[model samples]
Target: MSNDVKPGRAAAIKSALESAFIALLASGVCLWFLISETQASDDGDPAKLTMLAIGLSAGLCAHFVYMAIAAKRAERNATLWVILMVVLMPFTSVVLGILLFNQVQEIEQQAREEGGAGSAA
Candidate 1:
């Protein structure tokens, strides 16, 4: 019930937000490239395209790893989250990140309440 936030929870929330933002940015870049008139093999630069693809992959991978670690720390099923995120990356990464973030917040809040109660007794 206290407004004060723990450093660990704050860090976790920041990490989740950052990962989600990176995934969203990468997805937007890929979408823009797909809709643009640039052809990777033609007048367009294939090297630039390759770099963009690599960036997108890296962002997705980072998001997946973050989720997996967060799930494990929150006592959730890390394997299930990792599999789901991998199968639905670039499109569902942000959603999954938000879900995990909320779950972590809830878990932290419950722990705080329990600790406060124990201390009060």
Candidate 2:
């Protein structure tokens, strides 16, 4: 077999990135809904309130996903319930992504210190 290094990221990191991306999308959708609701209200539309609520919910869900990712990556000492609650919020997914990035940095530091530690047989 040829000695070719595999180009891949840790499974946990991939999951965290996925979660963060989804949350970002949700946040965008939520923002759009909020704007639409505001316009509807200006036009005296009865659906404005419902649209606003939808936007709020989307934002909340986004936050929770991020929090969940952080908790799974073992980078944060956040409580299960709190992480769940936060991850479900909008714009919070980005926060989780940032934290995960920080964790990766820490991992890199450890790897340097250990000098190729934990090599597979």
Candidate 3:
């Protein structure tokens, strides 16, 4: 692969990781709001809580879609990644992102070494 393509793939994976992290953060905030509202004596504003829930869902969905696209671009199993992201949204994303990033780096390094050897010969 061209050096340019390698960076583009890496950037896409990084962007996906960022998206997942944002979604995970939003999930935490949403959970905190839910717990606080339940524990408080006074009723919390339903509209605000509803809006927060909606935003959290949207963030998660965006993360899933972005990650799937990134995985596909990286020649990884997009469907499997999406399923894992959906099933374990809060915990699995960062691990998978790191694995994918490392895999891409390894691939790039191997390609570079091979190309160098081929040209030298």
RMSD, one per candidate, in order: 5.4, 7.4, 4.0
lDDT of each: 0.65, 0.57, 0.73
TM-scores, one per candidate = 0.61, 0.52, 0.70
Candidate 3 residue-wise lDDT at 47: 86
Query: Candidate 1: lDDT of 79?
Result: 92
- Give the TM-score (vs. native) of candidate 1: 0.61
Which sections of candidate 1 miss by over 4 Å? 1-10, 30-42, 90-95, 107-121
Candidate 1 lDDT by residue in tens digits, 29-70? 775774462654456677776766776677667667766766
Preferred candidate (lDDT higher): 1 or 2: 1
- lDDT per residue (tens digit) for residues 24-121 in model 3: 67767876776777678477788877877787677677778877876876777899888987888756677777777786787667667878899999
Greater-lDDT candidate between 1 and 3: 3
Residue-level error in angstroms, candidate 3, position 24: 2.4
Q: Distance from true position, residue 28, model 2, in Å? A: 2.9
| Residue range with the least summed lDDT across 10 consecutive positions in model 1 | 1-10
TM match of model 2 to true structure:
0.52
Which is the better candidate, 2 or 3, if ranked by lDDT?
Answer: 3
